[model samples]
Target: MTSDPTSDPTPGSTPDPTPDAVPPTETVRPDWAGIDRLPTLDLLRLMNAEDRTVPAAVAGELPRIAAVVDAVAARMARGGRLVYAGAGTAGRLGVLDAAECPPTFGTDPALVVGLIAGGRTAVTAAVEGAEDRTDLAEADVAALALTPADTLVGVSASGRTPYPLAAIHAARTAGALTVGLACNRGSALVAAAELGIEVEVGPEVLAGSTRLKAGTAQKLVLNLLSTAVMVHLGRTYGNLMVDLRATNTKLRERARRIVAEATGADRDAVGRALGATDGRTKDAILVLLADVDAPTAAQLLKASDGRLRDALERARHQGPPPA
Candidate 1:
């Protein structure tokens, strides 16, 4: 006998009749069926094994991540900002990454921006259905005053969150380059943006709790995106964070070490250079490596668009300071 189309599918049968409708892997994990009965040790082991798969998933999306990084760097070089929008874990991750940029890359606080769906309060406590509010996302992007030169990245673990989808649409309308980052393939978030990065991390061991492996994958991707873009923008000198703003004791010591290591200069020489450049690590390195005075080093850096390697080459071509 034929079955009723509207009736629920029997256990182990197809849940949805639509061929194009597939359940998100995040909501279906066969291995987690008897997880509640497992011992604490075994549960931890299972979680760890599942967590190990996150890096591999991220690795598969490296090419796409590289593309986004290059695009973001190009825009940033033209005075554009990198903006990230999302909700919950995704939003917190964006905020954390943006917060680190200032001290890590010497970027202005306004350069990298993170907008959460429920505003500041959402970062710590859940805002209750804020992720489903598309209007809030639109308002957040509008307040940014986006331009064509800016790049906006919308992050969502489900890939169907209304907040990020709305932000992506609003950002695109403002002529900003939009990138959608999601953990599921063929998501609305991905389809709506000019560039999409989907890292399929599969199901969570705890069932629907995306803050586990999915969160890890998002963090990994964000790390690569921001770090690579900064590297492309000359924020580093051969893997060293030359653009670091040494605001505290630890960073101040790091700045001195970076200068000494980059220029083979002694402690006193590093201190002198740091003082001359007002604790600017890149300028100190340039001053020492180019064997030029502070003013000349600053000029060379400015001429080369703050690229240390380019400034060094220019200084080399100019020959040694008049003996």
Candidate 2:
């Protein structure tokens, strides 16, 4: 909760003469006054009702989200990276999404990056005054060495967070595509970037605790952004993650099931196909569906830029590689 300037001032610290207008996420709801007096069930119901409004707020930003996804996909197609920068809850969310991309969509760990204000330690513990450090933000962006082919998304609930704003400015200066994701409109963070997505989730149930609805909105937006970009980059085949990296026993079993589902093959055939392809699910599917050897399937996938559907079409048209 933010301190009221009129109520009290820190020792030896004078309040600013001109305070900025309160952000929607920071504003208290008059109707929610004395919410502490409510029963547990009533409180739960109130919070749940507020949570339901988040999706509609996100829905209103669809066109903006689509544009950012297309832009990010094009850059990534050329080997560029997608980076997310924020602080606190926003920062943690970005890191989580980035870390998941490799296992879920078979992307290089370096291809999607996340930077939080105050470095790695802040991810688990609060680093006091870290979010206010613009220098740290600039240094973080500099370390990435971003290029025009890269995209950086700055996330914040208030739209005025100094860390993400500075990071966005530094990325823009580096010729990278800059996008701002915030829960409030007309924010400095939004104006600093080339593209802006504001979900406008309004006030949270507990007033300024943006980690509730704002965090949810940011997570949803990041989900849409990363997932849709992967789809456009051919990491998926008809809603299936064709490029999934199965690194564990469960994932290995999943890989077999996916190959079976895609090829309509029995378990034995799936096992044989997976073995021939070295357990590569996409290659196994291509080998079965296109009636090609493992080596030919690999070549087709490479030619089609790892797009399973395209490789299958090419293989069908070319008949079979030499017997």
Candidate 3:
């Protein structure tokens, strides 16, 4: 007898091919199915509404983020490096944040490293199958020569990307702290790392395109992580970026303003103090606030481990600078 094509061969077999599909939370929303048919204004409004939820989702993870930042700061104070590894949009964001560290916090370029699955070429265009290569991730971590002092952050929107998972494992094996940032909960990437940060931004408005809300969530988390770490490491003085490297005309002007604002010093004194310190903002601030020569300010800063507050306190305890 001929069998029906639609009939299941086994008694308990499912006819649907994709039985173990992605969870509904990660799958595309049925409400957004008609987005293409909506008017331009409505479409824009809908997308904007979806974007608004991202920040709250990020805010919910603040306690965890703080814990990671504190841990990273302690390690970094011991000369540890912050390394970010991922693929695709997540990778690009990591690279962008790493690149910005130098000018923003006067960090050495090598101090915060970003490694993408396909290297530099994958930043602009997708490389075929690069994200699936776990070996490449292992090799990249090995090249960094990670130690107990370093912290590695693996970013993946889906949380199942092989590249970052492997990188996390490799980093852990090398005695480094590992963190996983993903938009989905209970992901393999999160399970493998020492710390797991799942933002849970929900399904995308564009149906699985995570570069929208998920990407924004990642950016916000990264901003918090790096900025908080920098602040904890004494890179900032009273919300001012004292460690900024003034590499351009605008930054130089900003540096002078920062000195004036920080110490309540006159413009002329700011200029003179900055000149005395060779345009180093932190040293200039110390020179003005501590009432000491540039060299003395440098020594005090070194003694205080570059903490402006501690240096000021020590300088105050020593009384006024000798005439």
Ordered list by TM-score, greatest first:
2, 3, 1
* lDDT for each candidate structure: 0.88, 0.90, 0.88
- The digit string of per-residue lDDT tens for model 2 on 150-183 reads 9999999988777888899899999999999999
- Which is better, 1 or 3, measured by TM-score? 3
The positional error of residue 13 in candidate 2, measured at the CA in angstroms, is: 17
Report the C-alpha lDDT of model 1 over 152-212, residue by residue, as the tens digit: 9999987877788889999999999999999999888899999999999888898778889
Among these predictions, the greatest lDDT belongs to: 2
Clash count for candidate 1 is 0
Worst 10 residues of 1 by lDDT: 10-19
The deviation in Å at residue 27 for candidate 2 is 0.7
Clashing pairs in 3: none
Candidate 2, 85: how far from true, in Å? 0.5
Which prediction has more favorable TM-score, 2 or 3?
2
Clashing pairs in 2: none
1 or 2: which has the higher TM-score?
A: 2
What does the lDDT come to for candidate 3?
Answer: 0.88
